[model samples]
Target: MEQANIQMTEPGVSRADLAKLLAQALGNEKASDVVQKAASKLGIRRDPLDKGQALSVLEQIAQTPGLVGITARFAKSRLHLR
Candidate 1:
């Protein structure tokens, strides 16, 4: 399969919104107590993430031996890089 390039920036999706989406997708709240729990469960950093950062983090995680399959399922067109 050919590789797809994902841009970290989107013209319509705000950075904060992307962060929130990822949090929800992983079963967490945005900038709330539940975020800590959800992040810990996912074994990712607990720091607040903006849209671009969230994309970068996701890309890195997708490269892991077991994470790509699961992450790919979350790659929707509305949020994909152009």
Candidate 2:
């Protein structure tokens, strides 16, 4: 089986940064809804997502198939992992 190239974001990533990246990747109007749904689905609490939770949301979107996933991967890449 071919392993997928999953890129991980750095720890301590701020919520604002993640939200900005998602907005850039998807769109300004849709980012909030998407994050809300993703967090709910992932069982993550709302209001100020911690580093791990934010990363999880990013990874979830990244794994989604189609433009959403592709764009998320691109956005995820912009984050500093090291």
Candidate 3:
């Protein structure tokens, strides 16, 4: 499988949006837990409302084992590294 290459941009979905989407995709209960786990691993606070912080959380999730399968669609076309 190909790895996702997400990019940061001004007119893209925010971290909160991404979290909510992930939650919906993974079912309600697992969503928050997943976000928390990803955030903790990324050294970001467990607040989905902060976009910048949430990006770090997403990055961490992207690096995790089996996470690519869970969040591949979300990871697509959303992140751009400098």
Candidate 4:
């Protein structure tokens, strides 16, 4: 699959927007948990993440090696990665 190369510094989707999409994909409760885990793994130091941090976390998720990563990469493509 061809994934968009989103730069860490580039502005992407908002945290709330990403959470909403994730909620739709993985259920309401799992959304926050996924973001938290991704953020924690990426060393993001805040809640209500800034766009860059959110993108960083999303990128981390996309790189994860498993079915989750495949799902995440597919979802990442749906986001505005500009």
Candidate 5:
């Protein structure tokens, strides 16, 4: 199974939601690339909200250039917005 698929099996958050968050935060095309890069740097698969790694991955993404626009508040509000 894909890493994202495995991560999505639990609950709470879904891979699609995580992807949407990244896409919105970083902008679609860029977000896709940024997520892949962040995943590699974190030594984790491209599963942003994977178990215990979610927050850490998000933190790393937030530190990336141009991603400061993505705030914790925005992430929290995402579910409600959907």
Candidate 6:
């Protein structure tokens, strides 16, 4: 991805919470899947995203249909760390 070096602030939401929010937003059991896909797309072969990777993943997610506003709200707010 061209935006590989994105920088990110650690959010206040934990993995579970983030998944919960994403599940709610997407209305399915695919929040974690989304994260994984983004991570894979970014070529991240590890658990617990580094700050930049997290932002990059979120940025990718934001581009999905119906997710811009939801992701904006999440990105705008502090997410809890797991």
What order do candidates take by lDDT, descending? 2, 4, 6, 3, 5, 1
Location of the lowest summed lDDT over 10 successive residues in candidate 4: 9-18
lDDT tens digits by residue: candidate 2, 1-82: 9999999864465555666787875777677666667778899776576666776787788888887777677766666352
Instruction: Determine the backbone clash count of candidate 2.
Output: 0
TM-score (C-alpha) between model 4 and the true structure: 0.61
**What TM-score against the true fold does each predicted structure earn?**
0.32, 0.66, 0.51, 0.61, 0.54, 0.56
Stretches of model 4 off by over 4 angstroms after superposition: 1-15, 65-67
Off by over 4 Å in 1: 1-46, 67-69, 72-82
Global lDDT scores for all candidate models? 0.44, 0.71, 0.57, 0.68, 0.55, 0.60
Candidate 3, residue 67: Cα displacement in angstroms equals 5.6
| lDDT of candidate 1 over 6-46, digit per residue (tens) | 77653443434544544544433432333343345556563
lDDT (0-100) at residue 77 of candidate 1? 32
Runs of candidate 5 with Cα error greater than 4 angstroms are 1-16, 46-49, 67-73, 76-82
Best by TM-score: 2
Number of the predicted model whose lDDT against the real structure is largest? 2
Question: Candidate 6 on 1-82: residue-level lDDT in tens?
Answer: 5768778765443444445556765644678777667667878775565555566667676677776447534752544333
- Taking the candidates one at a time, how many backbone clashes does each contain? 0, 0, 6, 0, 0, 7
Q: Tell me the deviation in Å of residue 50 in model 6.
A: 1.4
Off by over 4 Å in 3: 1-18, 46-49, 67-82
lDDT of 5 by residue, 1-82 (tens): 6555454364444444555676765566665565556556888765435544555555666675554436533564554453
Worst 10 residues of 1 by lDDT: 29-38
lDDT of 6: 0.60
Give me the displacement of residue 15 in model 2, in angstroms: 4.9
Question: Arrange candidates by TM-score, highest first: which order?
Answer: 2, 4, 6, 5, 3, 1
True-structure RMSD, every candidate: 10.3, 9.8, 10.4, 9.2, 8.8, 10.1
